[model samples]
Target: CQPGFFKASASGEMCEPCPAHTERLGSGALLCPCTDGFYRAPNDPPTGPCSGLPSAPRDLVATTTQLSAGKLLLSWTPPEDTGGRTDITYSVECRRCEGAACQPCGEKIRYEPASAGLTDTKVSVSELDAHLNYTFTVEAHSGVTQFAAQGTPRADRPPSTSALTTSLHYTDPPKVTSMRVDERTSNSLSLSWAVSPRPRAQPRPIRYELTYRKKDDNLDVTMYTVLILEKSSVQINDLAPGTAYLFRVQALSSEGTPGGSSMEDEYETLPEAHLTQNNTAVIFGAAVGGAAMLFIVVVVLLVRKRRRNSHTRQGPEDAYFSSSEQLKPLKTYVDPHTYEDPNTAVLKFASEIHPSHITKQKVIGAGEFGEVYRGILKAPGRKEVAVAIKTLKPGYSEKQRQDFLSEASIMGQFSHQNIIRLEGVVTKFKHAMIVTEYMENGALDKYLRDHDGEMSSFQLVGMLRGIAAGMKYLSDMSYVHRDLAARNILVNNNLECKVSDFGLSRVLEDDPEGTYTTSGGKIPIRWTAPEAIAYRKFTSASDVWSFGIVMWEVMAFGERPYWDMSNHEVMKAINEAFRLPAPMDCPSAVYQLMLQCWLQDRSKRPRFPDIVSLLDKLLRSPDSLKTIADFDPRVSIRLPSTSGSDGSPFRSVSEWLESIKMSQYSENFTCAGVVTMDQVLQMKNEDIKNIGVRLPGHLKRIAYSILGLKDQTSTLSVFAV
Candidate 1:
């Protein structure tokens, strides 16, 4: 016998086709067995009378009714077929449908008629979300008995009827019961609300619409805005100080329908004079008047006193007295020229110490200016303390000497635990030297490299937190450290990090961009922000960008930024929107913060204080560090080759533009002041025309060249790996 067909009995001489609902697995001389959804009938023919299963449930229907606020009533009909059996039961199951997939309705869903059975055809599902669609399935089953002679069992076989499926949608909007002011400030107020109490079956509002206005203002003056909040509280800002306002909130369903509004509440913004501005103004007025009167009296007295002294003054003495004065020994004085920028006003703030107080020990390191040495400083009746002395080299010009000592002037003003402290300077000596508190662990980069893979993520984060704290301190003082990197940070034996170098630091002025334009300097290309590199616009945000690169360095054990790429290449890559990849095995959270810092728009980057807070949160929750970081090496490493594989074409954007005889626009393509190669590559034909490339021939050349460059980039991508 072939599959699906078999003999009726062992005594049969020939094989016969299997009856309905019967199947055989292989060619054999045995009778077929009853398949699923089928049964054997009593007193059947020798050939076999396997009856097919009854049809699935029919006339299936579902209806939903609004029970009350946030509650819904659902009803369904039973299947029409019972498989010729009276003993039957139905099981109901429900799941939420997100898109095409069905997910189990979690704790938010509840079922009425706790256990769905054959007699209980209708089931009420509560706690349904108004924003979601739910699918419910009902299966019907029958129990039948089989005889041994027939070789069929009657245990509950497959459901004689197919499972019925239906969906329910609840669109009831949520009701907001109460609203109140939680807090108020001079310019802002925080409002919170409570939703009306209802069963979990009721759907919650997706958003809240807040309408507010001055208490005495008319409805026309009211301001309205929507708030999408996961919680019940929201802070409203830009309110007039010392003003009274009335607020009302209404809930919005997922369908964008607004429900009833809550009762209005009154709140008064804190007065600007709450800090005793009136009293302070009166006091200041009185002080100014008194000081003016005193100044007049003092001026009159000085005038009279000078007149009297002038009249009482004696005439010049004779030759005898003049000769005696001239004969007197002249006192020796130190020359001001021996000191660096002695005429500069900043020198007045630097404390000059005697060279005898500092005993130079061993040469510690070398810097751009000169060599640094470990030394001991002895104070009167105090213990000798270790210090680091930064000394200027010999054969230096007056300007070089001043530049070397300028760091002392900058450091002397800062006094923070995270900032390196400056001791006194030894300008009186032959070689000018600056002394600072010594750090045992030297530079942060070297320290991290030496201890790679030894410190936990918490420890690394702690170090970053300290660095950010120091940067935050600098930012608060309106100061920007143009050069911020791991090498500039000094680490102590206790693993505390402090910002040290101030060679390129500058005080920010009042500017909307928070930028300090420099005329000339050697910029740190790899660590500089795009605006700073292109326009010399240095701001605290640019420093934040460099700090991000430093973060990568710390996490990667002082790895060189951009690998072995040249500075020009790094700048080009950054302009093309290519960011550094996360270090191997770096935590996802830390790398995410690094990417945030490297945002193209500096304003979007987090401030130093925000960085400190984020690091603190990460440290507090160490488990977050377990998240694996992802990086696409191909995108990050797709750098434009200096020499094309075909041959040497253009080494720089200027060269490329010059090749097309558009040398007049060379300055436009340089990374200084304006346009860059990356920007040129992304420019459309319209952009080229707008940039004064009016000649069709020139425009065609530029467009075709850009297209060729894009093609070359695509080809390079294949070999990037």
Candidate 2:
């Protein structure tokens, strides 16, 4: 008797073929186990054919830099209905989706480190063209030989693995950084800019675009652009003398997609009198007198340098902008740790407020240490100002009280329009309170969501710019905001977003790498960086990652980061190199900045200053956001919607399968325990096959129906169908 045959004779003389869905491996067995993602219900008899559990390996998250070869990094999770088996592995497939046509990519496409039949759920694909989106499919396959004896009806057996798809959102190479006028003559200027560092693996060419236009409000100036390759700076040989011109530089991809640009700056070419060449005669006449003057000027410069060196005890903020002292206003910060007593530190920065001056209105929010209220703070001779008041709960321990007041000590040390102002602290009263300027519009995230569609792309980017400005100020202060997020940003009626909620902020003093290590409290998994989450290293880089999430929230109109993924899953995916996909219709340039903020290497992430600059450029040139980030971030793109109109019962995967006349496989879905539309949204061909679905036509129909539901819900993986 063969492995698929069984003996059904009292005398053991006759061997019969095994029934459908069952297999006998030893050539002559009484019965067979389920095969190919098949599993019988607990009550089913041993003699019956096995039922199948539907499953498919899901490769949902993707990352790319829009490299010349279009490298794509993909990550997936184990299939849910592993058919109750632990021997599951995955395989990958590539499909090129562009301009209304999505077809399987052939051998011409390349997959780094091998493309198929692997245990590790990550893969990198290369050799694809940049600036275009592509689709990918990952399937879950159980050990074929290990389950060789198990069988199902040849036509009904589901494929071992399913296809999981998602969108790949990326941008062109980074824009030029540190752009400035190197030399400006009466009729010419040598414009220079630096390109941000790129990975060695970056095969694409980074082209610098120098755009210039006369700064004139009276007439529309003709915008001139110079495309430069293999160089960071270019000399614009021709310009009107004494003309004030606006200049900006940007890096372009091979496909001509521009990332963010440099801050639009203006510099007037030196007047005609300053131009050189024929001025040698005049110079020679003055040479005799100029020598003495030059000598005196040199001596004065040396004396000033000596004086500056003698008083070189400036704060970290000075060192940050030392090369360009006028770039930022000088602000002094007295570290709270300097004071021997916490109370002394708190009082040094902020004055104590009398309880009578504070009138509580109503509760607005709660935190770990206290309840917050929107209230009034009235100082003598000043008008009553609305402010947010935080009160220490009555039952809080002395330790809790100190921890709560510690924030006041920190906030009071800073002064910036984007930074929340610390009004005053009330410690003498029974309930100690911290007062702050009230943000009429409330938290940025909720506020954006409340008015999602009402904001334009420019307006939204402005809000992000304000947040970045605040973060820049905080970063310059050598402070690490461990829990930066849209929720931590407060929006005022004027739509100005300021950094607030300093509960998780700490000073990273003297850390060469600008990092702070701590045993610490809870980390916001979704908003935190990989290094910060795993190694407890909180740094400005980590804050940048959170800021990227905040950017997503702002672009998505306050959509939650890593939607529908749990904390554990979010960490795992992030660790696996998966990042949050671009928001729907997000501007390509804006997404590019967000991608830089989320670089896995903490040191590689851009600084807040650079981020602020990028946003500034985008705001100056609103046309930069015209090109949208393109990707089918929702579920499968091929499936059709079966769920009825608005606020329907939310169709389950089984019902959709039934609607498509594929109800024969509903039992497989039931066996797989797939209930929601989201679960089915990610199901691939192999997943449907593994669940007792066989036959090309059936799989195709089901696959199309499943993927077409990409827009059916807001909960599915951004890359799945």
Candidate 3:
């Protein structure tokens, strides 16, 4: 009942001898008999104390080749037991045998290459008598047993032995001469190679190492396989269409020697299937015959219809068509470059004014392209007039120079009053310049910041109305201002706002959505529509999204759109269906328009013309401005300082005013008896003005700042609880 021994009586506590090449210890062991390489010698009773010299190695094997005429390769496993020792060595012994008797072939029995010894399980024996029949024997040796004899020590025990006899000849592995792609489809190919002619010999098994990879791929991504083939062909499936692949083949003989690899060959898969040339020709002929018959019938019908309508009375529809072409759907605008002679027609649109007639004054501002300067332009019949001269900076490449001039070409075609007028260009000068009507005030964002709440809601809405009018005009001409933002708009001394920047504008062709697919460019995240930013789709609808942000800018008096958030964060928030909260004290109606412009579905957003009408309506009804929403100042305006003077939260009116950059009004607050932070936080717009903060901008700033402090206090109290 031991692990390595069994008893004839089932379930009885008796042990019997283990099977051959297997052994076990004492009885009652649960596991089965140990296999070869783990067994020990059996005891006298064949059940207990099973430990001794190792058993003979099992599964002895040998092979020979004709290529090495006098050589025979031998390999075998180690013995089943080492007598409880680990250091085991193997030796290959050979003899020249006649019938039954044999004589040892000593010294002449040399392992291959004359370096391998008994330590190696595999050996190649050479220099043998090729005329004599040979027998090869392998013996396993367990070095230096630990046990000592009780009396006289017995002679060193003979090691375990296993033997095999072979007198076979070796043959060279076949050489693969050339490999090629035999056949190919869109996604699969078959490969075949020719083998060099060889002398006839006994049939032997052969294998091929097939390696393949995509052309230009690194070795790390290369794949290979070993195929035991009866023929010299293989089919590889699931290949990528129109992709090139490299293949190599090497032949391995039964002796495990690999021959030289065939030359690397490249092949490309066939392209996807399509209509054949004959089918296309047939379709073309059918379309031409159908079109000819339809044209003849239409000509005859038109002739008959004209005769029938000639006697009929003219209707109002006829009068409508006779008035002007403007009333009809206008033909799509085309880029001037598309004209046959662009040089002549392009010059007709933009005049080339000489630099000598323009006087450079001083630098007014800097722009992405170059610098802006206020200058005087002197024309033949025109008196000196102020103009903004945008001059290209030095060290500009030819491409940059072309982009600089493109804006002038776009502006020249625009004529709306709300659109910035391009007077002429000074391209002949060392620095190319674009001359346009100058605005006393600069960018709309900066103007809003400087005049925060100085202007009433009506005046701010008017500026927005002007911008919408200009955008509507551009939309009518099939133009898309890709980089529309408050910074691109200009304000004049008369409070007039005009759309200015045209560097990124494009005259779209006849597209249903007015969408212009761009490859890639720097996108303004906070101002860009979600779809445009994610997909590089620039359309009039995307421009509406940007205009929504612009509306927020005007209403918030130039606060950063997504306060303190990185471009990546803004993109993530917008993707998650989050929109910017209403700006501080922003009119509910105006904020509603901004939200409409920011609809996730671009088609749902209103067009520029519709926006203009809505703003005009809101402007007419002044009472609508009173409907304000509860604004989340944290997301709109900059957060107020948590720590006031003396490194603590604001506890008094002076400290709260100082935190909001209104330290100048601190004295006014003290004189108005607003001595505590609570009193200041509870104050309203009129109450702030009564406290001597007369400027609408200052009062509004104070009110919002107080609201922010109140929110902060409530947040702190929640956490305190």
Candidate 4:
């Protein structure tokens, strides 16, 4: 072995104790193996007895430096000696303060071995208190014994303070980042900023003071418009478009101290032409590409004449459509102007109406607004007439009453058979009561449930056709029923379905075709279209989407689509384009039509006219609806065809012979040649007597099966008349 180093034996040797911090493992007469945490220097004498790890550091000097985000980084070197051994491990320790007789630093200190190149050792201490003094020490150990390194015991350091302050000052001045028109009529532009770095000592929240100047004049008279206290964003209004302006920003410290002015970012106010859709070019590209393109083309042509007429006629409609979109708030706050109870407002409207010819009766239905009652009146000398009275609850404001009146006015415009009739309104009462035609069966959901699936596929198709006709009619009148669902559709005793509840409906006479939140508020998101849910932006396409859900409800006998899903989960599913399954007894073609309406791409959805035509076709072929029921998704359809003529069950012996004997052969089967048992029963008595034709029981059974009318519950029998 080397002069003073040797292995004790083949067995693992126990380390021999040396002075203070020295250690070495030994076997037999050989010296204990040098312990870890210390290294023997090459300059040490070869014959020297193993000594305590040459003053393995008990304390290390490190100064904490502030990095980004107010963090203190501590770095130090490894212990000097490995107790006269090559194998060594070093550890680092820290404390709150460094002074003589300072106790072992608490658990705050962390230790790591110097294995990889210790070349320039560095370690970071994160999440330190800002601008606070800290003392750190490094302790080195050789095996079980620990020693201190020769270094200054006090490592006085503090976290770096950010140069950024909370007050607004300018060595230079704050400048605008970019400027673009939001609403041309509103003349509003939103500005944003890149916050400056905050000092560790005083972390500052970013605030903005948006100032503006007219482009034509060069003056320091920059008018301060808005003071945004704790945000990087601000919206300024009352500025003329196509005007040049300058802007500047200053950072502020947490203590409300202003930092030196950042270099002013010079930006000119963009003319009305510069506003990308929703003030975001990226979101516009993703969500509103088509709408943007169409709008851009139209605005370019309209811009020249726009200055002549300052009073923008399109502003209300545009604002209504745009305002309903799902705008994410930059920060959370409680808005004071919240929606009020619509039903109470409607009732108060009823109390105000002092009608000369008013009539009320038994309540037919109860809605959010109030109750609907069946009423009749025989004015002076006129014949008695049936009317539905809708009385609102009390506590509605005048604005709510007017809004209800406006909704009633729109509902009054409809006169289609499938649309519920609205006669007139009594606004003088404390609450308003709208008169209309009454339906005996109430809502479609209740109507269908009462029928016990007794309505044949044909009848159901007819009902759907009626609903589609009403929708088409409304579309023609430029009206969209924001809440189109089975619950809002009433059915008369004749089983005729009529669309009702104009509380959430809108007449796009002077408005655009989009969804709007009424004074009542938004409808349940479960039935709303994806776009409407995402942005509160509604269109005829969105109405079509809701109608598709209604169709599913009707066919499913009122089972909700994707039942029991929370709004957030439903949104995730919808954004992923998950759709409701086709209901039992729903014809593939009809279901396909509904799916077309529910297409994720709103533009690809079908118009009401197309939906009407498709429903009509399905109605004509009632058998198609039955055919749809036979389709099982879990298994492939293996329906046997009865079209072939090979003397099999698929073919009738008589029809096969007739086809074979025909001199002019044809492979196609004519609808005329095909006969059902019902046709045979319709034969004239004299012809039947002359022919003496009698159908055997088995033949009758076969005929019934062929006709697709074989019922498991009913036994077929010949009538003896």
TM-score of 4: 0.38
lDDT of 1 by residue, 17-90 (tens): 77656665687746777666556555455466455443345544554433222334344455465545555566
What candidate 4 gets wrong by more than 4 Å, as runs, is 1-356, 380-382, 429-431, 505-520, 629-721
> What's the ranking of the predictions by TM-score, best on top?
3, 2, 1, 4
lDDT of 4 at 51: 46
RMSD values for the candidates in order, in angstroms, are 26.4, 22.5, 38.0, 34.3
Per-residue alpha-carbon lDDT of candidate 3 for residues 609-672, written as tens digits (9 for 90 to 100) = 8999999888657678879867755444455346656533576676567656578888888888
The clash count of every prediction, one per candidate, is: 8, 29, 8, 67
What lDDT does each candidate get?
0.67, 0.70, 0.70, 0.52
Cα shift from native, residue 605, model 3 (Å)? 0.7
Q: Give TM-scores for every candidate, taking all chains together and pairing residue i with residue i.
A: 0.42, 0.46, 0.48, 0.38
Candidate number of the best TM-score = 3
Model 1 scores what on Cα lDDT?
0.67
Residue 67: error of model 1 in Å? Answer: 64
- Name the lDDT of candidate 2: 0.70
